[model samples]
Target: MTARERLRDYHAKRDFGRTGEPRGRGAAVGDEPRFVVQIHDASTLHFDFRLQVGDVLKSWSVPKGPSGDPRDKRLAVPTEDHPLEYEEYEGVIPAGEYGGGTVIVWDHGTFEPLSHDRKGRPVDFAESLDHGHATFRLHGEKLRGEYALTRFRTGKDESWLLVKGSADHARRQGTPDPRRARSVHSGRTLAQVAGNS
Candidate 1:
């Protein structure tokens, strides 16, 4: 399906009139795969993880943010496809709206799929995601090196685990204490961002 068609649920959940979020009307397929992590201060604070595929961004709602330790498995609940422009979204959603809260661009970067074939060739990222597993190397200001997402058996399709992979570039930056993390875009804390909105 086209990216526009894939964002039906996203559009349906948000009202552009009340929120400043982009209407997502003109999405174009990007040349390279990108990744974004947005710290969303909704009723429940969580991190929105997104990966570019085709013209849409496959997303997940990570409750405790991401970790840099291979042993740390963060719970990731899959969400709807978001528009590519949504990667730059960092503001407030009005009260009573679907995801009424403040948002901050925690990290934005490009990534390369690390899944490989039996012959040791890189496998398609989309295909890896379809098979419920994907390993990638992220090149971001704060997060570097390999990470992985693995879908565990759950009756619902949304359950997945975000894990850090052992890589030379991977550091011991265990999950940022959410309380102390600041936005990469604005250098503001979640409370500061929320109060300003």
Candidate 2:
């Protein structure tokens, strides 16, 4: 198959995985399912975590940021998928970019959506989300397992809390900082990965 065809299949099959969006100049990437959760240490000092849900990536900008404590609920405000180029963005985003700040992929890894409602009946993605509980399993270097974010049906995008449900990955606040989170990438820190930014 041609390169474009290969990429299409890659995106189709590995639609959820996170890959470096080459910018300026870089190497060719592989084809595999990708799901990323970048703890971008931006100038604003907030963490940005994103996951490829379907076509467009699901995103969140967390301030005071991700606490490992399963009981501690962090605010996760949803946003749009920055162009794939954003995957590699670091340093300073010119003045017009969406976030426009120093970027750092604090932590990332592949994720799996957990199915079920509070009552434990196979819940659909849309249905669960509509009611304010999009639980899922995460297999990242830092965070993992049944997580939920109660979305405010009547409030603006500013209404959500990243909560952890009963799962294999649960701990205390800042117990596992993203900096300490082993990288799936080649021995490179998210900052180093985006350092060139």
Candidate 3:
């Protein structure tokens, strides 16, 4: 589907005049697919993980955020498709609006699709995701290394697992405390961002 069609749900849930979030003009796709992890201090704090697929960013609300440790299986709940411009979004979403909260760009960078088929043939990244699993190597300011998102459940309680790959970049250290983690874009914590807004 085109970006406009994919973003219908996103647009329906948000009011552009009330919120500062991007309305998702057709931004140019980059050479490599991009990924962003944004910390949102909404009703319940969570990390917003987004991966560029075609013209839109397929998003997931990762409760504990992505980790560098392969042992940690982070729960990722699928959300709406976001605009490409959301990668640089960092500020407070006005009160009473959809997803009203403070947001900060925790990590943003390009990713190399690493999904492969049963016979070891490389599969299209979007196709891989449609099949409920996709692997990729993230080259971000803070998060570097390989990661995979695998769907564990479907239907009413759909969810996916975000886990780091057991590679050279894997470390014992997991995700940091959400409250203490600072934005890689502005080097500001959630509290600071909320305070400024």
Query: lDDT of all the models against the reference?
Result: 0.85, 0.55, 0.93
Where does candidate 3 stray beyond 4 Å? none
> Can you rank all candidates by lDDT, best first?
3, 1, 2
- The parts of candidate 2 lying over 4 Å away from their true place are 1-34, 41-43, 83-91, 117-119, 167-169, 175-197
Q: Taking the tens digit of each residue's C-alpha lDDT, what string does model 1 give over 1-197? A: 87769999999998888999887776665666888999888899889999988777899999988887777789999998998898888888999999998888899998888998779888889898988899998888777788899999566665999998866545666667665678888898888887897
Candidate 2 C-alpha lDDT tens digits along 1-197: 33333235224432232323332122233342234655554456567766554333456777756666777878888764433434544444533344444455555666656668568778766467667677777666667666676776445635688877755555765534545443444455545645655
Using TM-score as the measure, the top candidate is: 3
The top-ranked prediction according to lDDT is: 3
Question: In candidate 1, which residue pairs clash?
Answer: none
**Which pairs of residues collide in model 3?**
none
CA-only RMSD, every prediction: 1.7, 7.8, 0.9
